[model samples]
Target: MTIIVAGVVVLVLGILAQVLGWGAEHHEAAGHAAAAHGAAHEEGSSVLIKRILVSLWHSNLFFLGVSTIGTVFMAINYVAYAGWSVMVKRISEALSAWVIPGGVIMLLVFFIGRHDIFHWTHDGIMDKLVNGKPNPHYDEIIAGKSGFLNLPFYVIRMVSYLVIWGAFSWKLRQLSLQEDLNGGTYWFHKSITASALFLVLYAVTSSMAAWDWVMSVDTHWFSTMFGWYVFASWWVSGIAAIALTAIFLKQAGYLKGLSSNHLHDLGKLMFGFSIFWTYVWFAQFMLIWYANLPEEAVYYNQRLGGFEGRYTGLFYFNIAINFVFPFLGLMTRDAKRQMIIMKIVAIAILCGHWSDFYLMLMPATLRGENGFLIEIGIAAIFLGAFLILFTRRLASASLVPVNHPFLDESIHHTT
Candidate 1:
């Protein structure tokens, strides 16, 4: 906790330095722009910074959303698999710590920019007087989902999801640490039970969240596979995060007990999940394409529209990077065991998923194809925040599960 508090302070200062340093430089350049051509060009560069910041911002929010969902799912997997992932579980749990604050910021962003992001938040447009009674512009649809999609209800649902997932993540992590100290089964049993309960809740909340956050952008569209599709997206992303973190820890001289076997396993999972995600992607695409139903086809049409070409390109490229590259790159047993090879694939996989999510969110929100400064800024801030938090948490504790009965199993993690 002390580490977190101190790290937050340092991070705030770093962000402030960035803002002040860059802002001062821009202000001075702007003041001189009228006097010189070079100065005017320098002023143009500030636009670039703004665009970059926007891109970072959007990317960061996407990461926060995916990572939070991944944390909850990973915890659920720990219970369902009934095996030890104690070695990497801390990394998963830490991924979620960013969710509460991230979600709050996102909510603020949504409300502040409601006109830009959401069509339904307007009283004059979405909500209006009809037949002497209030009727939303998207009345029929909104009426159908009034129970779940109204602002008040939406806030409550979102809070419930966050609170449940956050509580489970913190508690499960506490138990894992407690077990390490007490060397008892009691904490383990409790953790397992709590994880089980959380898993059931996670499924429901994850589906709702995917719908609420992403799917609702196209309020008229609906798909039963949407939830599972999102699951596959973030599951692959989360696993890649684990692999990347594992590699970093190995290089930094922590988790030295974790051998190449663990790397191989993590790499293999990344490879396999990439394939699984692609399968889900193609399955969803193929069905909609072949069916040719107007409503269903609208989703693709909007995605493949002229305004969304770059996103579409990334959408397909995500397949190549996530599925093809990893499939070939990690195919060999030897390759999966090699840390360098695994890290490269891990990066590719993570970037691919990031693009994958960019496809999911941006097109729906911006209603356009290309990313911008706002997106970049958001992504950077969130990425910086997570890196700071995760690293600090790691530094404060032992990397290995020192008291686990299967700690040896994880150390050797052999096939």
Candidate 2:
């Protein structure tokens, strides 16, 4: 209740500040214009609702990715037969509680704000040579991608992805609970098979969803590594969230079996994935920037300074917050094992990734015209709602996996 109320207050204040202080802003990406020399131009109209809708979409994607990745983290452990994470796996399970809400919010945002969020959603944007003349609404680039980007197919993909992910999360949690009741390998083995299948399916849907939800915002720019980039970002954020929650539970007298060794392992994951995310970011950015192809280069140009230098700071901030901070703060093994440090770092990673998602859509859609108050309010509401579900789910189950095959190993896990 506290969480929800605080979020609502923040949201109301944010909306008021945005309306009374900023007033109506331009519809087009604030600082963007037609790209020159074969670069595709993204067009926009002045829609007042565009701001909130984009903010909502951004938050929805962030929470949804983290929630899905939580299940993936647990599933990957099951697939690998890892023992060290048995104590903390429940944290991941709790996160699954947010998947449905996140998906619903996703569908809601897409329907309400499709036109503002995606340039391709514009009517007739995919038509070619209408009436023997180039159609005024024709986008040659978008038209070429029309087969996959059409509305019916797009809706189908989003709906299917959510359904598939929600089912997997539910199944995994159910199997875990059943394992506790039966105290046998039956559920465990079933989980391995289920997890293996989910991973294979995830490998495909994760990337395609990234293309649809995020990369499409740019309309003309695409990257081969975007799927991996988004995955790595979400993975680190989710794990950080898990580790942070575990630390809190430990301090609050839950997960008494959890030790510094477990904290150390969690820290290592945070540190390592932060670097992995950076590697993908660099690989994607350097390759595109180096190639200097008009279409590809213009993508960076928009965020780098093409838009009156609005996004340049954010681009670097994303790197520093996600990579540099973690790299420096968690370099020492002792740091990861420290409860306070772990909590602080986890909170930082969460906020950092939120900003990362912010950059993903804002530069292309909001054009830096977004207000932080509203964005923060939406984010806070998401965190509160997710916590409401996560904590409820967490309390409803045993914090410790009483019958986990590796419960002993995890309790005694050493880094």
Candidate 3:
């Protein structure tokens, strides 16, 4: 109830801030100011609103991705017959609920906020002629890629990815519940098979989804490593989320017998993936920077250069919070075993990765200093709602998989 109220309040406050901001801009535009100034202000407000909407949509998508990935992580454990995670598998499964509403909200944004978030959807942008030869609208490069970037196909791809992810998530949870009730190897066998299949599907779709949802925003830029980069970012965030959720439940006495060993395993994952994310980040940047190709370099240049080079600071800050902090903080074995330290690191990574996503999307979509308010407001809205759903689902099932074949092994698991 508190979470729901907070979600409503944050969402309303975010909308109000954008509306009021637009109203002020509109008022300034309508004043007896110079026509150029008025037009500039109007354009600024428009972009600001668009940026806020994109950030809101992206944050929601981030939640969805991490939640789904949390389940995917569980699936991998299922397929691998891993015993360490069984005690907390329910928490991972509970997070899957976010994918459903997240997908619906994303679809709504794609259709309604299409013009605001996607430049390719705007009038004459794709079709306009350049130099009396080809596409204009300062996006000839994007036009060249129009065969794959068209609206109809883009929409189809986005929907397909969501459907695939949502289906697998739903089916996995159903099978998990069924296993709990029946206590048979039949359900277990089916789950393993399904999990194996889901991993294959995820490998392809996760990359494609990253390209469709994020990379295409810049339109002219491309990155072969982007899919992995996104996966790494969200994957680590998922691990942190799982760790945090387990800690919360254990503290509440709901997840009795959840030991520090489980946390150490999760902490190890958080530590490893943070490095993986950093590697991807550097590999992507270094390759692009070293190659010095104008097209590819423009991507980083926009983030690093320009008068409003605040993104440069965020770029480093992203590394600091996501990689540096976690790397150093969780370096020692003792640190990973400490619940207090683990919780702090988990919370930091969550915030850090949120900033990572913010850096990825916002620098390309919106500009200026208003991002802090928008980030906090949008995060509050999504995080609050996410907690409400996740907790509700967690409550719907046993804290631990009571009938899991490896239940005893999991409970007695040691680092």
Candidate 4:
């Protein structure tokens, strides 16, 4: 009930802020041109709405990626037969329940808000030529990629990826429940087989989804490392979430068998993945910076030089929060083992990754428009919704898997 109420409050606040923000933009535009107040107001409102939608889209994707990768965490454990995480696997599974609804919301946003976020989808841009030469509207680079980026094919890929992910997540949950009821190796074998297949599907679609959903934002730019970078961000965020959840459950006395040893493992993952995320970030930036190609450099220039230099602060700040804090905060073994410190670091990593996604997304979508209220309000809405969904799912089942083959191993796990 707390989660539900909080979700409602945050969602209402976000909607209200969006309305107020649009109104403010409209009023400012009308003030600038009294005679064309109506026209200017309409245009301004449209632009502001687009900005809000793009921000919401990115926020939704951040939460969605976190949820989807939670399932991947479970699948990896199942395939590896890792015993340490058996006690906490249910937390990961519960978190993954968000993906079904998240995927639906994502698809709806893409269909309705594509024009707002995707430059390539705007009308008159695909075929437009500038003074009989290549104009910015009809970008030759984007045009060349149109065969793959066209609306029909793009929609198909989006649907296919969501279906695949949703199907696997559902199957895994079902198999786990059956395993709980039946308590046999038969269910375990089935889960292992399904997990093996899901991993393969995940490897391909996760990267392709990154390209379609994120990399395509800068339609003219390309990066081979983007998929891995995105995976790292999502993976690290997922691990942090698990650690945070485990800490909370442990404090509540709900997770009796979960031990500090299990948390230590999660902490190690969170620490290691934070570095991995930074490495991919640096690799992508270093290669682009080294080459200094006009097309490539333009991406950073817009982000750092500013939409025209407004986002300069965010460019550096993103690295500091995502990389610096995690690197130093969780360096010591004692730090990882302490619940208080782990909770703080986990929350920081989650926020840092959200900022990272915002930096990747907003430059392309919002341009120079920045507002604290809108950003926070939109994020709160998603955060609240995720909590509501995750907590409700968590409540529906035993906090720990009771009949797993490795239950004893996990229960007695120590470091």
| Per-candidate clashes, comma-separated | 28, 0, 2, 2
Model 4 residue 7 lDDT score: 52
Least accurate stretch of 10 residues (summed lDDT) in model 1? 36-45
Clashing pairs in 2: none
List the global CA lDDT of all models.
0.66, 0.86, 0.81, 0.82
Which regions of candidate 4 deviate over 4 angstroms?
1-45, 128-136
Better of 1 and 2 by TM-score: 2
Which residues of candidate 2, in runs, are more than 4 Å off? 23-47, 129-133
Residue 394, candidate 2: alpha-carbon lDDT: 95
Roughly what TM-score does model 4 have, to 2 decimal places?
0.90
The TM-score measured for candidate 1 stands at 0.81
Per-residue lDDT for 1-415 in model 1, tens only? 4444554565455455545554444335333432242221122224334333334435555666666754665566566653346577667766776766666666666555544444444443444467778653435564566566678887788788778867777787788778778886777668778878988888898888878776776666778788888777777777888888888887987776767877777877888888888788888899989989886787787567334243566666777897899999999999988989888988887777777777776554444313333343345446677777777776666677577655666665666
Model 3 stretches with alpha carbons more than 4 Å out: 1-45, 128-138
lDDT of 3: 0.81
Instruction: Give lDDT for model 1.
Output: 0.66
TM-scores, all models, native as reference: 0.81, 0.94, 0.90, 0.90
Candidate 4: global Cα-lDDT? 0.82
Worst 10 residues of 3 by lDDT: 36-45
Predicted model with the maximum lDDT: 2
State which candidate has the highest TM-score: 2
